[model samples]
Target: MGARAALRHGAARIERWLEIEREQLVLWLPVMLGAGITAWFVLPDAARWIGFVLGSLALALAAMVLPGGGRAPRALAIAGLALAAGCALIWWRAERVAAPVLARPALAVFAGRVERVEQLPARDMVRVTLSPIGHADLPPRVRVNLARADAPAGLTRGAVIKLRARLMPPPAAAVPGAYDFARVAWFSRLGATGKGFAPVEVVMPGVAPGADLRARLSGHIQSRIAGSGGGIASALATGDQGAITEEDSEAIRRSGLAHLLSVSGLHVTAVTAAAMLLVLRLLALSPTLALRWRLPLAAAGAGALAAVGYTLLTGAEVPTIRSCVAALLVLLALSLGREAITLRLVAAGAFIVLLLWPESLAGPSFQLSFAAVTAIVALHESPRVRGWFRRREEGRGRRLLRGLGSLLLTGIAVELALMPIGLFHFHKAGIYGALANIVAIPLTTFVIMPLEALALALDMVGIGAPVWWLTARALDLLLWLAHITASAPGAVAALPAMPGGAYALIVAGGLWVALWRTRVRWGGLAPFAVGLGWALVTPAPDLLVTGDGRHLAIRTADGAMALLRDRAGDYTRSMLGENSGAEEELALLSEAPDARCSPDLCLVEVRSGARRWRVLATRSGYMVPWAEMIALCKATDVVVSDRRLPPGCIPRWLRLDRDTLAKTGGVAITFADARIRAVRGGGSHPWLTPLTVQPPFAARPEGGGRATR
Candidate 1:
């Protein structure tokens, strides 16, 4: 009886906590979605749509059957249901875009409309995105590299053209655990990418699908404005970064103003707010309209319309749509004269963006933009901040000072809040971002954005040259400011790679603390500490293997990563050099201080602690005797070859070749106390299958049988 009473008391405590959280529970939907996706990627099974559906159904059943005797049980069940919902949504999305993949490079000849065109700066060629002919004939969409001499001087969108191109599968991850190009390509609905050899045919001509408004707007701006001014104008107006040069992009990044380059929340919010205020002033000037009708409502509606126009004029990506949605919600609240709720508005935006593109959960733009905005909203809308701002508005002079202070505060909050995420994805963070914003944001907000908008407006009437010139002058100043600020000490700092699950956990903990309005929210710091600890203590991999198994690299005692080969394929060399993320050089990894090497083969001994293991690396020529191969395998612990070994080779020896490397994408070997273990570079992604291995063979069972003892 005493134990039962104790249990009841504990249950009551949990119930009260749940009640405290109920008001803000909806905002946790993204957290649930992120958890589900993380689980999907980490799970060691080949998940199909049928499995996801069944799993969702099972979860739904469990939720329905769960006892309602306690609030704790109900809350747990709801969490399960949310996870199931996310799984079902992602599975459905993946199935809709799945396409047949090409296994080898072949000359594919197909005639289709060109949807997008980008000029290759280094080569005198144009890269074109061709529409899919059929779901089965080729990939859903193909990017063809066309030599400029064989085609028209300029190829705009929607030009029907026939070309011969060497087509291959969309590339997989460039390095083990690096960016997954294949997954991104799948989500983007691109099936193949290649270079066109001979392209000399044009069947028809029309405007591009997305270029109807952007093309006309960009062309007018370029014609009216020249040089970097026109380039910046075109980028801001039409969401084209290709017009900006590499040096300008680098300058912007170093200055901590790369956010300005993208059409995101800041640009959208500023443009819509400015348009609304202008409309409101005009409405206020009409005495009869202002007194007789709801001028505020009219202005709000006009603002929403402006936002829609801006969305269409610029690139309507996931982050841009999310900002538009948030702004519209705020306008709706104001028009109705209802109190605005920040959490609900953010929740709605997140729901809509995730519903449209679930894969965006993995992108830096969505995470950083949302995190910053959410943190700012939480800070500015808090009671203490509201009271302070109200006090600051006591006089006209104070109001100006308050506005400047608020801007500075906002920049600080956003930069600090987004620091961990930037570090996780880019392995770098800007220390002087807040200071940079002080000089950058005002120029952009007051002078640059307004002037660019006016320039576009004037271009519609063919009188844009004067305004374009002013805009160019402002842009030059902005560039000069960027160059100065970015050159400051500690402007940007580099970070090492994080451990498994560190990024997800850190983000989730931040959300937990930000979404709740109680002092108990401090508990979120525990998970954050755990993630940071993982990042600090986790040792990087010792050995790097390529997807093709032809090249290998390892970290040496002298602290520079060393490669096994002096020369390798471009992809292999790049992946190894980049993925190591440490001080690296092109020096070869040799077993002995002085090693013997021939054109076809090289022998090296790798020393780890008290243990030593031999490694045999060779180029093509499987025609070598099976006995010689067996002896080489017996003498070495690892065998990396350019081509596949003969069927008679021993399976017990650890080996990687052209035939078996794709299974794991790559592997990282770790040696501790002379015992070696391997960790996979590629995780569970739909584009590349989940990797599984114990050692000697990672090939299909039928192929492994040939080398079995």
Candidate 2:
């Protein structure tokens, strides 16, 4: 009798809790849909069809149960249906975007029509996207970088050109859990990338009105502003960021002002709001029109038109399209006298974006943009925040102070929300991003963008020089602020790659806290805290190896990373540094006193607690004798080489040569308690060649083999 009473009490509490939260249920639709999309992306290719079949069955079951089920069962059924629909939608989208990918690297002469041309002023190169002509063997589209001197004259979009170039398949991740460029290229229909070796020959000159206008505007902007500031102005006006210097770009990113360069929600809102206000004021000047006409509706229509025109003029990037959708929604709400900004508006925007571009869910832009908006909306919607705004009126000075304080608080909330995403994708988060944004946001929104627009308008009548000068000055100040903030001590908090489980925990907890209105929302902080702690406590790998086996890094006893090659390229070094969580630059292993080196190979001994391990890596292309290699492999615990090892040349612990690296992509190794643990890279995805099953490499324990897969 006592057990039955306790069970009944627990059930009642759960039922009441569900009843209290029923109104907020609609907010979870996108979350359920996104879950299915994520599962599709992460699942193996062979299992996708099976999973889809199962999802369809589940959807049918849910539909049958939803009509007559209890509250809990009905909620579960709705979630199930959304999840299954998401899976089906993404599966269809992937098939729709499928195109031929380059199978291997080759040097060939080909003719193609230019689709787009991007200038890289910093590198003195111009990258052009082309649609292959008369070559069924090649990919539908390819991108090639040509030196300024090698590129032909009148190289613009729609021009037919011929070139001899070396083309390679889209690049994969450099290290495990790092960025995957191939996945991005796959969705974009770009199958290969290459560099032009010979001068491009122009067969015909073609005209493109959009490309020509953009180029002319960019050239004009650069002529008006003297330095890198002009590049920023051009980016704002035409979305051409190719003119920005690399150093300035880095500074802006590190300082957390990078959003200013992207034409996202902030820019869209500014343009739309400006247009609406202008239209409203002009209509108000005529009292007859104001009294007789639907002024707000007319203003909203004008704003919508402006938003659409701006989005198209700026190349209709994914972020721009998303902002446009949201802006249009806001206009619709205003015209109908409904609340303009709400969580529902954001959810609708996300649903539309996902419906159109499901693959974008995997990108940083979509994640960061949506996360920031959701956080801001959740914050402002809180009862306490609303109460504070309803306080008695105050003096002008006090009102100004309150407004600034609100801006700062909003900035802090957005930073906290974006931290997990930043760490997951970049392995680092800006420490002072909230503080930097407080100043940067207003300056860009009020001073720089408005002045830029005004100057462009004046340029049509040939009196824009003065306003253009002011725009340049303001941009210079913005750049200066970015540099100062980025140079500050401890501006970035770097972490090693976070585990997927921890990342998921943080995201789930954040959504729970943002979506719920009851005190139960506090429970989400528990998982959020645990996820952060887990990421901070996890140990980084002891050794790193690139996919090509040409570069290697090991953490030394002094707690510094040492590299096998000192002359590695900047990109390779940066990637190694990020993955290893090294705060300082990597030093050459050859400079270490404990390392021994020959012309072809270098050997280093690393100690972890009481266990000592030996690592031998190739230093040059020169091949060592087979007998010497066999002897060396026996001596070292691990052997890493760009070339394939000879037969019977296995090491006591592990061997990572060309054949293994080709399959694994990259390898991260850890040593502890007389055991060697290795984590290999590459995944079963369409963009990547499927990895074949292989026999486990055996590591000898006490002269007997222990297998590792």
The lDDT for every candidate, in the order shown, is 0.69, 0.82
**lDDT (Cα, tens digit) per residue for candidate 1, span 443-492:** 88889889988877887788877987899899888787777876777776
TM-score of each prediction? 0.84, 0.93
| TM-score result, candidate 2 | 0.93
Report the lDDT tens digits of candidate 2 across residue range 188-252: 88888888765578888867534587777877888899668998988887788877888998788
Instruction: Give the least accurate 10-residue stretch of model 2, judged by summed lDDT.
Output: 700-709
Runs off by more than 4 Å, candidate 1: 46-74, 118-125, 132-136, 147-154, 208-211, 222-231, 387-405, 460-463, 480-490, 550-553, 562-578, 583-637, 645-654, 672-686, 689-709
